[model samples]
Target chain A: MNKQTYFKKFKNIKYPISRRGLLISFMFYSFFHFSRKLYANGEIGGPFRDRFQSFRQTFRVEPNPEEAKRIINNIIKGRDKRNNLILLNAPDIAENGNVVPINFSVNCSMNGNDYPKVVHILVLDNPFPEIAKFFFSNQSGSADLAIRIRMRQSSEVVAIAEMADGTVGEDRFFVDVTIGACS
Target chain B: MARKNYRRRLKAPLTAKKGEVITIKTMAEHTMEPGVRRDPKTGLIYPRFIIDSVIVRYNGKQIFRSRWYSGVSENPYMSFKIKVEESGLLEIEWIDDYKQSTFKRSVINVLDNNGNEIFPIRLSEPSQSENLQ
Candidate 1:
């Protein structure tokens, strides 16, 4: 139909309009312009700000492996025992980077003296690479863990475990991206 | 105040035999709200909403745990393997940064070496647990 005819027919429709409809239409149109401005200004800053703040207050360093190691090492400085380590990597080809399944098992002796005290996983290249930090006691028998993570791109994944006697261990994995995993 | 919504689902078998290493798949409905998006009406930034941690337990004992970040998607899905040994219930609990928590439970049936259902146990109700703090 021609544009003029379409407009005429639309206006002549025998449906009664309520004030709510007019108010909604006006709000919708106003929102369209408002959203355009927001997009142009790029004012988006989600939960990442809180994450950044937390990292800054806790570690005072970037969320990279080297930085993480330094921070963790400082926490265990002056200790005498070694820590067991396991490196976990995403699959060679991830279908989605946003929610990639990553698993790591630390072969630690479950004995009272050698049990793992904590497990920390870090992604070196993500916007916020610190994926998870798990603290365990002797009761948590095994040091094996699995989790899903969001990846911005191909990056290195690292896992670090601390033992009861101050021993520290480490693991690393490389992830290749076939698809973006984060929105 | 904005209303928050979250949900989770399991994709693995609900029953397994003792010592059987089976994969458990789970996904949750979440906004994973980064708090970065601007309100089209007010032009103000939204608050952040994301899952921070999850724990899985069998018969009152923790078997799996994890901590997540904002990089995760709006609705997050996770898969992991657990070796069952006793006839006990399976439970999963998820918590967000806002101090909100949700729990899900499923019955686990322990089987014999011949794959016979020998023992069936129901997991605890996560919502009713006082350990959520």
Candidate 2:
């Protein structure tokens, strides 16, 4: 549709009424539907993919093993691996970087005999990724915790849970961040 | 007045099993202004004002402590687990770079899973005295 017709058809729209605006709007409006269609057809790389590619280029943080090791050293200190009792829950693709809901839970009985001593969350690519450290005592009664954190862009999220007996448990996963919360 | 709007909401079970593990969730409302980010209009860097440390203590024993940087997102939300040793107090302290401090306290009670109070076994109990006699 022509820009004039498009604008007139959807009048009262105060902004983005030019030809470029109309095209951009049309693309933006159909991005989700088109992406869905591509997935349904078992195909990849649609119009939205191109836009995301550019976004990735601009806000990408390449995963570095060395950097992750550095972070582990800072947080976990000496012990890095122990048990697979920790869960790091995050979306495969973050629709909004501004408000990413991330939850990290340590699977250990809050019983006096066993419990998590501390839990730490780190984003591999954040400019300063040491998000937070959580300490737990017996009175806490459970080792479950949830927290929302920000990602600079697309990077790996690491969760490490250290038990009172010095047992270490951890989970790591990557998240594709679209819009950065740091901005 | 501005600081008043910045708030913290903590959710935890009022009671848990004597040794049960329960989850605690918290959400804090704050701008988390990164000192590095510049105001678009004024072109001046907004001073860094982020929660610098969060310490949680249970029954007067330190359980959790975190040191933070400005990279933390705004309105931080965190969850973690702990064992319930006994009925006691859960105290949370938050400090920011601006030297502002906030404290939040919640009372926690411990009982059996069936909701019965878990009484400690005392050596001087009446039943124990009768058995001794």
Candidate 3:
């Protein structure tokens, strides 16, 4: 039957709603109303945007481990697999941790059909752990990047590349800092 | 704004083979006070003045961007790669905590193996450079 005829025929029939059904929906709405629909990283709506906010202001005083946990959790975002698409380069034994190089690249054809939508680098132990977050459009040409970051102590660094298909690749490397950098 | 007259040096090649990945290194000499340190002279907290963001764009398309914290070393050095596409102008913008911005631009030449322009020349190499002269 056509959708129009089906709707017209159904409109003539009235079914009484049960009180239990109404109560369940009201409870469901109230439960979610207390919680904001957001990811761990505060991605409120839409694809990831290259929005910049004050990182220091997010947590005051000493480098709070709890705050870093929230930030790194947002970076990982429950993605699966430590794939080979991302290459993370770091010195196994950094003579000076003050300027350790945290470099990485995503393997993908920078075509409109598929590309890394965002690339994030996180240092697990820095006072401000998030080192870099890069948003890549098709015009980015390539996915490779290199930069210097400071590490306060021996810690694991993670690089995750989020592709347009909603899947992500992760890579982790460790740096042995001889002397602390973030004091 | 960062210290007045702070200089930015971009050490990179003006030309690259098309599709070849090349490393572009940049460094800016400026003091990045994190605001936690108390000035010896005043015995008070020094206001933070830091270059918080660095963005690199080529042919008007942004390629790489990063947020730098105060923990980043002084004279911040950033090195990264770009897959050489069509040649155009490469611009670097440095933004600080004080809303001050510094801009440096370079003419990128994406040439084929042969000495030919792979893309239309947008800007020439720096005229005063000893290499070009």
Residue-wise lDDT of candidate 1 within B1-133, one digit each (tens)? 2344555787657666666667777888777755445677997666666788889887888866777766666667766666666666778899988778898888777778887765543235576465554
lDDT of 2 by residue, B1-133 (tens): 5765358888889978776667777777788765557667987666556777888887677877776655567888877766665687888888867667887889887886677665444566899999999
Steric clash pairs (candidate 3): none
For each candidate, give the TM-score of chain B: 0.78, 0.82, 0.82
Q: Roughly what TM-score does model 2 have, to 2 decimal places? A: 0.65
In candidate 1, position A109 carries an lDDT of: 55
True contacts kept of 2: 0.61
lDDT of 3 by residue, A1-183 (tens): 798998999778867876798899899998665433443246563222212235333222445556666665665577775558888888999888767876787878877757888787777666566666677776666777766677778888888788888887888898899986643
Question: Cα lDDT of all candidates, in order?
Answer: 0.65, 0.69, 0.71
Per-prediction DockQ scores? 0.17, 0.24, 0.24
Off by over 4 Å in 2: A1-68, A73-80, A109-115, A163-168, B15-17, B109-133
Better structure of 1 and 2 per lDDT: 2
What is the lDDT, from 0 to 100, of the residue A108 in candidate 2?
Answer: 66
Q: Pick the candidate with the highest TM-score.
A: 3
lDDT-based ranking, best first?
3, 2, 1
| lDDT per residue as tens, model 2, A33-130 | 77766753436642112112111122323345565565576556577587668988889999877677777666766667588777778777765556
Which candidate, 1 or 3, would have the higher DockQ against the true structure?
A: 3
